[model samples]
Target: MVAIPQRTKGIEVTRADDATTTEDFRRQRIAEAAQRARAEAEARRAAADAGNPPRPREINGRDGPEPVRYGDWEVGGLATDF
Candidate 1:
């Protein structure tokens, strides 16, 4: 029987004619091509967003002063009784 040779992970490999099927190799190639296409599309989107400025939001409610809280809790102590 004839033998087929394939290189994987920097190693030389050899398999018999029936050992590896054409469908297995085709699936691997299709998956790799899909990954490359997705990566390229993402790069294009990032470049476009960087060039555009951020838009401002509209406020429909009345504006008022907001309350601020500072350090009201004690440190290294629990409020719950055992």
Candidate 2:
């Protein structure tokens, strides 16, 4: 009986650090955006509480200016039929 030791040649094992970095970057970017949105909303609410409100800019998707709504306001604006 003869014993032979064999090794695999030219088989490359790679660590995909690039993929990990890309996914991590995307996650961090999304988290940053969410945090910024939350901060902005909090600031706006505080301003409203102080009797100073903000208005939307004309650059938005709407064709014209929209009233800044606060505290249980309806999206359909003021309702009629009183």
Candidate 3:
């Protein structure tokens, strides 16, 4: 006759321990990802506000150079909204 082994208390304890470890690891990974995302956002913001002078770029293939728009369009050196 085939015999089936009965579940032991030690097995349950080990399983519980593993579950706790997995949860902790998951939380740590999530926190790290959030931190990285925040850092990337800050870097993007800094680059955008780097104070570099705007250069004129052609808009819609217009014949003349269109002002390099930063925030608002500069028409005759005066800031105007589109």
Give me the candidate number with maximum lDDT.
3
Per-residue lDDT, model 2, residue 72, is 38
| lDDT, candidate 2, at 34 | 100
Q: Candidate 2, which segments miss by more than 4 Å at Cα?
A: 1-16, 52-82
lDDT of 2 at 33: 100
**Per-residue C-alpha lDDT of model 1 across residues 1-82, encoded as one tens digit per residue:** 4566766643445665533555567678889999999999999999999998886653663233321234324334643211
Considering TM-score, which of the candidate structures 1 and 3 is the better prediction for this target? Answer: 1
Model 3 lDDT per residue over 1-82, tens place: 3444434432332454466766676788889999999999999988988867666774655333343543435656876543
What is every candidate's alpha-carbon RMSD to the true fold? 12.8, 14.2, 11.4
| Poorest 10 consecutive residues by lDDT, candidate 1 | 61-70
Off by over 4 Å in 1: 1-20, 61-82
Tens digits of lDDT, candidate 2, 1-82: 3434332232232334444655676788889999999999999988888895555555434332333432433346854221
Cα error of candidate 1 at position 56, Å: 0.9
Model 3 Cα shift for residue 71 (angstroms) = 15
- Model 3: which residue pairs collide? none
Model 2 residue pairs with clashes: none
